[model samples]
Target: EAGVTQFPSHSVIEKGQTVTLRCDPISGHDNLYWYRRVMGKEIKFLLHFVKESKQDESGMPNNRFLAERTGGTYSTLKVQPAELEDSGVYFCASNYGQGRAFFGQGTRLTVV
Candidate 1:
């Protein structure tokens, strides 16, 4: 019955640092996704996961990032050697069987 939860609501890291963000969706949801909004731009889809498998990842920016859903429970997005351009608000959402997505407060990443 709880909504999605994302850790570290805000992050500040130096360029080239590695950061991992975690997302825990509602208990019974099977659809999970990561989205981003950069500097006032429109929210962009980053990836989607159906259970433990990545369903769609075309929106992922580059190889510097990695996403995983372990045991089909929680998900994590990791950025290695992060770039300044990666600074943005990262959102996590989930739903049950095609239902409307419930989003977290989002983790604001600042790479300086």
Candidate 2:
């Protein structure tokens, strides 16, 4: 089974542009998570989805970012009016129940 897949491995956009990042987790995995490392800071957890519902989203920066997992199949993270401070590598991970998470190659976003 494929672990996890992320689209548009890299994105370069002007400030204020909108960018969407997608993540497809391993089949049958009910625990999905989103994480990121910004400006050499610790890789922080953005959110976690148990199936289609968001279980934890304490690390989300603000309202400009949104994340969704439709029907518990896949997830998408959208950033509206992207800012220079948002440039970083966004990572997605998944697990079956309580085991370790399997991470996808991150999507690098550069806001100019």
Candidate 3:
């Protein structure tokens, strides 16, 4: 079975533009998370999803960002009006509620 997969490995957009990153986790996993790393800093948790419901999203930077896991199958993170500070590698991970998580090849986002 496939692990986690992220689309459009890289994206470059002008400031105030919008970008959406997608992630498909391994089938049957119930826990999903979105993370970000800016300028080599440690990965910061953005949100967590249990199935199709958002379990936690306090880590999200602001209202300009949105995340969703539809039907508990796949997830998407959208950054509207992208800002320079938002430039970073966005990571997606999933697990069966415990232990090591399976990560996707992060989507590198750059806002010019």
Off by over 4 Å in 3: none
TM-score of each: 0.98, 0.97, 0.96
Report the C-alpha lDDT of model 3 over 26-65, residue by residue, as the tens digit.
Answer: 8999999999999869999999999999999999999999
Candidate scoring better on TM-score of 1 and 3: 1
**Which one is best on lDDT?**
1
User: So what's the TM-score on candidate 1?
Assistant: 0.98
- What order do candidates take by TM-score, descending? 1, 2, 3
Which 10-residue window in model 3 sums to the lowest lDDT? 93-102
Per-prediction backbone clash count: 0, 0, 0
Per-residue lDDT value at 27 in model 2: 93
Ranking by lDDT: 1, 2, 3
Clashing pairs in 1: none
Best by TM-score: 1
lDDT string, candidate 2, 8-90, tens digits: 79999999999999999999999999998997799999999999999999989999999999999999999997999999999
Runs of candidate 2 exceeding 4 Å displacement: none
Cα deviation at 106, candidate 3, in Å, is 0.3
